[model samples]
Target: MSSTLAEQRAEWRERIAGIGDTLRAESETNEDLRQLSPATEAALRSVNAFNLCSPEELGGVNAHPRLQTQVIADITSHDSSAGWCALIGAHESAWLASRLPDSSVERIFAHSDERWPVTCGSIAPEGEAEQVEGGWMVTGRWGWASGIHHSDFILSMSRITGQEPEPGKPPPLLCAAAPKADVVVEDTWHTLGMRGTGSTHYRYENVFVPDEMCLAGFERPPLRGGGWLARPTVTFLTAAGYGFPLGVAKRAVEEITRQATEHTRTGQRASISEQQHFQGDLGRCVALVEAMEGYGHHLFEELLAAPINSLEDAVRMDDRARAALRWAHQTAEDVVRTAHEHAGGPAVYSDNVLARLLRDIQTVSQHVIQTQSAYIRRGQHQLGIPVRPGL
Candidate 1:
């Protein structure tokens, strides 16, 4: 009998779990070299771990952010870097599909050559898109384009001529689709962790994006396209993007608990789990994760209920979603730190999994969404205070 989608997902989950041991080892070596191993990349592709975020109709698992984050958490428990890359890559196409015209969905998925997700982002307005007869001529370089090494397409962000966004005005965040032929990967992903993700810089010179390929909120009834984007953009993709850290944090908590149960200090005969102080720490970590999980669930439910194109209706929910992300990352940081501390001196050892988990968690927590300024803005908005500009 053929396997159901749920069964297939379970099978893939098991495969990812099995590779965790190898990924853990490779990630350590990659950290030393500041690059991911080709073997690791192949391992991710073999099990189809990058399709977790695709739409159900598109041969993807089509999991919600809550379930998707849980899956990523499971994978990262054994190897944070692998989970990070896998989740981010899988979601790229899903996000793009949501913004595209309904008629284009079949073609995007029908393209047999389009394997892997299209990971691209640059909000600095570095790329310029000039309006043309049928489409726009996009030309510029975008930094930090992840998952492109193996991705079949690129979703480049660019700035176009438009009026200054007014209060309550939801301006379009321009995204231009390009095949591999139109883009060049610069191999410039040198970082503290997630180095193996191959998040390289990309260069686009005079790439002509057809009107049918360009995605913008103003271009409704998208030129014979098809995908999830029949509605608004910010309310959907922004919520999805926040799930990555939640996965990383969940793994950090689980690893800490497992280590606490198995390992013992040199002078102590009993494991760290037997100590009362350690018990409190582990218990608190559990509570922290539970809290984040609750916050995330509530925000997702709110997002699901929000009407498409109802920005006014979504403003409060959007603020809540941002707050949830901030809380999740903060909780993750605390849990990971506590876990690292419980691991004692071994946590700092290059070969130890705890060391890498610490680095990965820290790297994600530093993202702007989880920063103090983002949280303050959300909180003030929620409280009806006048939030300053440039937040």
Candidate 2:
């Protein structure tokens, strides 16, 4: 299965290479218009590129987490927006793997096989729920729901029906899985870059979610004895989310190297690749990429080998995983910056690939997952010190 998954990803890589230029062109226009292109959407669905993270048990080949990021990086080298959307959509299956019932999982595959790929979900606590006869009624708005335009189903998080809250406490987030009919997708994804991601806000109004359709992290029945596999879904989502942009940074470095070698600096007749200074800079970038990749793979392999076991165990693993995420983001940021600086002014021009790569890298790097402030807070909290706000 592993070999097959690798082979499949390789095939997808080749497909991306073949269509990368087209996707890039379309993506550029989409960025200009602040919307996604139909061709870009069709191409992704054509390749089933969004299914890369689906678990093997769900009639989808679940590739290794490390390899998944590698493929995403490859795609990002071609088009950042497509890579971001692809990874986001593909990761939807990973989050659903733990919570969705077999029937719903099958339905996902059934529709996916038909070529309607869905992505983006609301898992944060930002909704109201009321108890009903058979299930619960949930209504709320989830922002930053990327890939919703193409999604066939939308996952919204809402409070459990009849749930009580303390004076200052908000309701807990429950995973309310429902079809797109239950929510309205707003095309509000205007941003600096990665416009093709179609990350918009979604609203749910009086949506009825059956018991089987709802999944919550802080609430779930424990096994009679014990089972590590039944751990919370939040851990899985957090771990899988980092793969996309990490891949984008990897690709940015590659493109930067390619462009750096072909173009000469203002003062030099030879390409940057021929210069000692450029060589040194590129080498550092490569080393950072290598080290980040190694650490990310090591930590991810551990999680996959164990999956989720216990709350304490998951928490411990999350610490290491978060550390890996930080390294990946920092190294990626440094590498992209090096690439941009080493590539020079011409590479910064709109027509240059380095410029686009730079924009995409920057756009995705600004996400909360890669934010340095979050890392510091996590570290401080782990050290038994009070976490400073916005640290």
Winning model by lDDT: 2
Candidate 2, residue 140: the lDDT equals 90
What TM-score does each of the candidates earn? 0.80, 0.82
Tell me the alpha-carbon RMSD of every candidate: 4.2, 4.2
Report every candidate's CA lDDT. Answer: 0.65, 0.66
lDDT of 1 by residue, 2-107 (tens): 2664665466567768777777668766566454566667777766667666665566656655555556666665566666667666666665555566665567
| Candidate 2 residue pairs that clash | 73-247
lDDT of 1: 0.65
Pairing residues by index, what is the TM-score of model 2?
Answer: 0.82
Q: Write the per-residue lDDT of candidate 2 for residues 108-150, one digit (tens) a residue.
A: 6565567644656867778887878877888898877777777
Poorly placed runs, candidate 1 (over 4 Å): 1-25, 29-39, 46-48, 101-107, 112-117, 161-173, 218-235, 238-243, 261-271, 307-309, 386-391
